[model samples]
Target chain A: MKIKLCLQKSTPRKYLFHFIADDRAWIDLLLSKVALIFVSIIILAALYHLAADAGRMNHDRQLDLIAQDFCSAINSAGKSSYETAGGNIYFFDAYNKYGNFGSGINASVSGEYVSVSFEENGRRYGSVKPLMYKTLPLSEDEVRGELMGAFSANGNISQPIPAFYGYTAVTEFLAALGTKEENLNTSMEVHIEKTLIYIHNLNGTEVKELEYILVHQ
Target chain B: MSTSLFISDEKAFMEPHNDIISTAMIVIGFVIFAAILSKTYLTYDDNSLSLENYRQAALIANDVVGYPAIQGSRQDLISAYALDSITMPAADREMHSDFFQRFSSNADFFVDVRTDDGSHAWIIDRYEASSHDGDIIAASVPVVIELGNNARCVPGTVTVRLRKNKWI
Candidate 1:
């Protein structure tokens, strides 16, 4: 009995096949893929760290510039003539390059340094600049009373006093003496005294003399 | 024939190691690029700081030439009498200190006043060479020097040299 012979054509496989010579080759492929992913993760992490460091450096530079600018303004005012009226005003705005306001921007004077600090990404950054001369911080009341006394002695109470002591009303004085809050913006008034002003310390024990006064305006 | 040709094509198969090697090379290149970029940025920052120091020196020079205490009979003039008092071998320490107080305390600098004819020269607040280890930025301004005794005015230059310190 002769069986009927039949010829059939096989269709080509649509998907490509990768032949693994051995289990070791399979393990090698798997390990290499894992290593590539690990390396990519490491590269990404490194890039992230580098970017963060650069951002921190930029923020530090901004703080430094703010301190330097405030210090320079103080020095400039100190060098001006004592007879110059209406001391110069320095406006400090803690605005970043992106035009967004910085958080917790504050400036203060302690010892011989003017320090400006701000917060970024939950981190606090600060910079300090040395003052050209001895400086004292005075309140509105103290400044006004001192000016009134000085002007009265000079027999020029009606005339405006030189170096930011000329305002007659408290409102005008406060306007010139800007807020001292730790906000996005502030102003400082720098003035030189015609004569040395003696002040008693907080304890009213030690006397300190100041020729330059930095007021929050 | 087509299947044979496709299988024989060189691009049909790639070694897995090549992927990792290429990725590593790319990462290395990126790192190098980043290093160079940071280096350039730091250089730019340093250059800008130096420029600022030079500007500060220039301002100090201008201010020194116009100082009320050292000014001659006219504006923008330096008095020989005042210069002598300030720069004499036994200069008054108090007066020198007072004069320097007019400038920023943070600035480490000195001034040199001299006549164009080399008749007179004075160094104000001369700092020792070893005191600072940095570049010196100098700015000069022309002024009229009045000889108090002879009642004569001569051309002079005031040079202000600022030591570039990290703090400033």
Candidate 2:
């Protein structure tokens, strides 16, 4: 009887072992759910980032187009039209004559800061006390240095011009600027009448200079 | 009586085995759940370089140029006025005012008038202005000068600010 019982047990246990009920169904289910959540979050985040990048690129493209349009106007106007109010050139006038800024980019303008200087005449009779202007987010050193050189230098300030940051729009005009020329016939005066215009780009990375001389023909 | 006692003992042993197996399954299930959660939470990629490049480009677009008009000095017009002073020069004054209006309409800016002693005063002016973009760093101011009687001159302090409006 003992030998027969051992043989039966061997066959029965082998079949049961092959079909054991130790399945990890619950563990696999939970792990899959958690993994799905993580992957979803990463996908969503990437999507958001891509959308933001697209918007920024669009904005930059618009600004670039506007800058180009402004440059064209300044160049065509012969620089003299822009030199009103020292260096202030009215955008309204430009627009009225040539339609709105071609790029359709919108911006608000405001004063950033102010400066004043006293100057003694150089080989001229009268002394001049001048007022200087600047936009916001600019350092004192940069503003002063550029103005000082521009005041003393001859035609068109030299290269390596100062760079500017911040501010949406910038303009310049001449309250008063003059030059004296002496000739063999007699002492001649070459007055630089009218205002000079400077248009600063939205990024402040570029400035368009417009020169204006009174038509003394 | 002996057979009845054997059956009762077998029942008690079977109950304990069932309890042990159930408890082990519950613990393993919880461990798997926890590992999955951690793997999802711990993964992240960095894109700081791209962010920095975009920021720099925006700054350049906003601050490439300086307002040269506001850079001029605003001192008393007595000396130059007296020398070239034509009594009742309303025409010239009107022309000058018109010029100023043209400059004023271009953009908004502050005009700082500084004295020799380093004491400074500023004026706020507005122009019809727009920007490509502006940033905190790489902003600058432009100073423009309008010479008097063609007499060379210099200002004490001149600076312009490029204000960048930040989103985010």
Candidate 3:
């Protein structure tokens, strides 16, 4: 009876051990798959953050261009007339002549300073100037169209898109921020003191004109 | 009996298609890896900070050139800025002070004024070179020249140089 019991114990247990050994490859495979999934998620999350940073940079770049253009127009006006209050300043120096700077801006000159502002959500965004604010009645596109027609009428279609998107401004800020695009309204303004420039104007002294540019998008 | 057990074990090992799932996972992981690599590698910088500085310099140049020189509280028309101010800076201490105040900042700023013929040149600004390498943004804008008087307008160049910051 002792010999029979020993043989039974050794031989029967072999089947159970062999079953577990056979599944080792499958267990490794399952664990490897799960690890791969976890690693992929981590890498993807990191990439998402990088892409979002790039998007914010792009938005900032756009705003920078608009601000530069507005200041440039004002500088140009300062060269000739300090009496420039009402004019097509959005296309001043052809900064936004392409109508790319979306609408919601207003510009005008009051007293001795140039005034520019942008409106979003029924709220005006700008500095506290001495004069009251009034939203411009025209959009950037409309202003551009009118200017284009005027230029074309004079047989001078020299207006060209000023290499604004040389490399296609890559911006995914709204996407990365998981924010709605319609809610963001960007506006920028610049104020430059007009200098008194006396040129060949007989005996009349002339001061540089103030220019104001506003963009709403 | 041992031979029979070994045969059954080999059959069990081959029963599941484990290799298929492993290959699929590796392929998917590799694709994702490539995508992340491309996004990181194919980056193009669009930082126009230098250009913006140039534009800013140009704007300031306009103000400097357009500034009219006068006596008796700006009521009198007199040419204050001319080729002489470059040589005799003491001629307009107040004017120079005002300009220095306008363009003062943490950055190194310089205003090199000269004629188109390169005849007269002078610098009026606040600039100090840091102890390390840095980015320098400069712009040369034409000023409205005043022909007869120092406060008049004409065409001249106002070169502006601004060293932004030290690069690490």
Candidate 4:
């Protein structure tokens, strides 16, 4: 009975082995191809994210440098204007220096700070530096009109306003004497002026005051 | 029979064991990559911060050297008389307050002016020993010191040291 069982099992086992051997190669190849594709996709996705993060970091560093440079320029111009007979004019080319990489770039000086901001990949990045000189606050419309008038007088209005030189109506040039614009790519003129203003004292006497005026041209 | 049973059991155990080992290897690789990336980022950040601090110190030094209040007959020239008056112990309080008013309120720094010969030296700000506890960034610029009314000018150096306070 044992010999009979062995003979019957051996015949079926040989056929089963042949059948499995025929199919196993195809199945293994298919599975390995699928796994390779999945791993490649994961690696590519990770690389893309790392590249994006590095780009963002680079943008932030550039923005910080622009802010520092603007502050240093303001300080130097203010110091020179304080001593010189006539005020100083500093030409800051934001777009050329730091705005080339990011979009919706804006620079402004409000109160005691000079700030630069931009947008990248649906995220906003900004940097600010403190100014050593004092500034007087003024309204946006007033500053815009003054800047327009100055540019017009200098024959700079013959060419169309550069894309980066102007801002939308809703955006306010909040800095009293600083420039404010969105999508900025043009150069800006910072005019530091030492002017005299008279104020009425509590005793009704006229007090002469020396004031530093910063204006965007 | 025992050998066949052991072989079948080994086949079942090896699959899950291999999977766990591969998964652990992937996790370890990711952890190492992340650690290296973070360390590189931190080092870059530290270097940039140091550069920024030095730049700030340099700006302050230049501004102090060109300040009109301390300037002599010409610009970029330090007046000996003014330095002498301001450095006096009796005038320290008023001078310190004046310097605070002159520079940005955010700046925590002091200025040092000294001749090349070490004959004269002056500290423009009220400096305390405690201020040295924090990280200090310093910058210096060449300047001309006016000794007297006879137009005797001596080369000097103006140094600005900025203190960076660490947040807890």
The candidate that wins on DockQ is 1
Q: Ranking by lDDT, best first?
A: 1, 4, 3, 2
Ranking by DockQ: 1, 4, 3, 2
The candidate scoring highest on lDDT is 1
Please tell me which model should have the higher lDDT, number 1 or number 2.
Answer: 1
lDDT of 1: 0.62
DockQ of each: 0.20, 0.02, 0.10, 0.12
- Give stretches of model 4 more than 4 Å off: A1-49, A85-103, A120-122, A137-190, A193-217, B1-19, B72-77, B88-100, B115-120, B126-130, B144-156, B165-168
Per-model TM-score on C-alpha atoms = 0.67, 0.27, 0.41, 0.59
Stretch of 10 with least lDDT, candidate 3 chain A:
A166-175
Order of quality (TM-score): 1, 4, 3, 2
Selected candidate, larger TM-score, 1 vs 4: 1
- Write one digit per residue (lDDT tens) for candidate 1, span A1-217: 1111111221232111223222235666787799889989988998898888888888788777777787677666665566673456556752343233443567776325678887767788888766644444554355556556654322133333343332233223332432232222343333323234433334544433334444443
Better candidate by TM-score, 2 or 3: 3
Worst 10-residue lDDT window for candidate 2 chain A reads A123-132
Q: What's chain A's TM-score in each predicted model? A: 0.52, 0.31, 0.32, 0.49
Q: Is the docking of candidate 1 incorrect, acceptable, medium or high quality?
A: incorrect
Cα DockQ of the candidate 1 complex: 0.20
Model 1 chain A: ten consecutive residues of lowest lDDT = A1-10
Instruction: Give the lowest summed-lDDT range of ten residues in model 1 chain B.
Output: B125-134
Answer with 2 or 3, whichever has the higher lDDT. 3
| Candidate 2: segments with Cα more than 4 A from true spot | A1-34, A37-217, B1-99, B104-106, B119-155, B160-168
Per-residue accuracy of model 4 over A1-217 as CA lDDT, tens digit each: 6445555676777655654434335545565566656666776787788888888888888888787776776666555534463655655564466536533567776556777787766798888776665443333345445545633311122322233333221112223343433222325566555432222223433332223345344
Query: Per-residue alpha-carbon lDDT of model 3 for B8-53, expressed as tens digits?
Result: 7654564444555665676677678767765654453214555555
Q: How far is A175's C-alpha from truth in model 2 (Å)?
A: 22
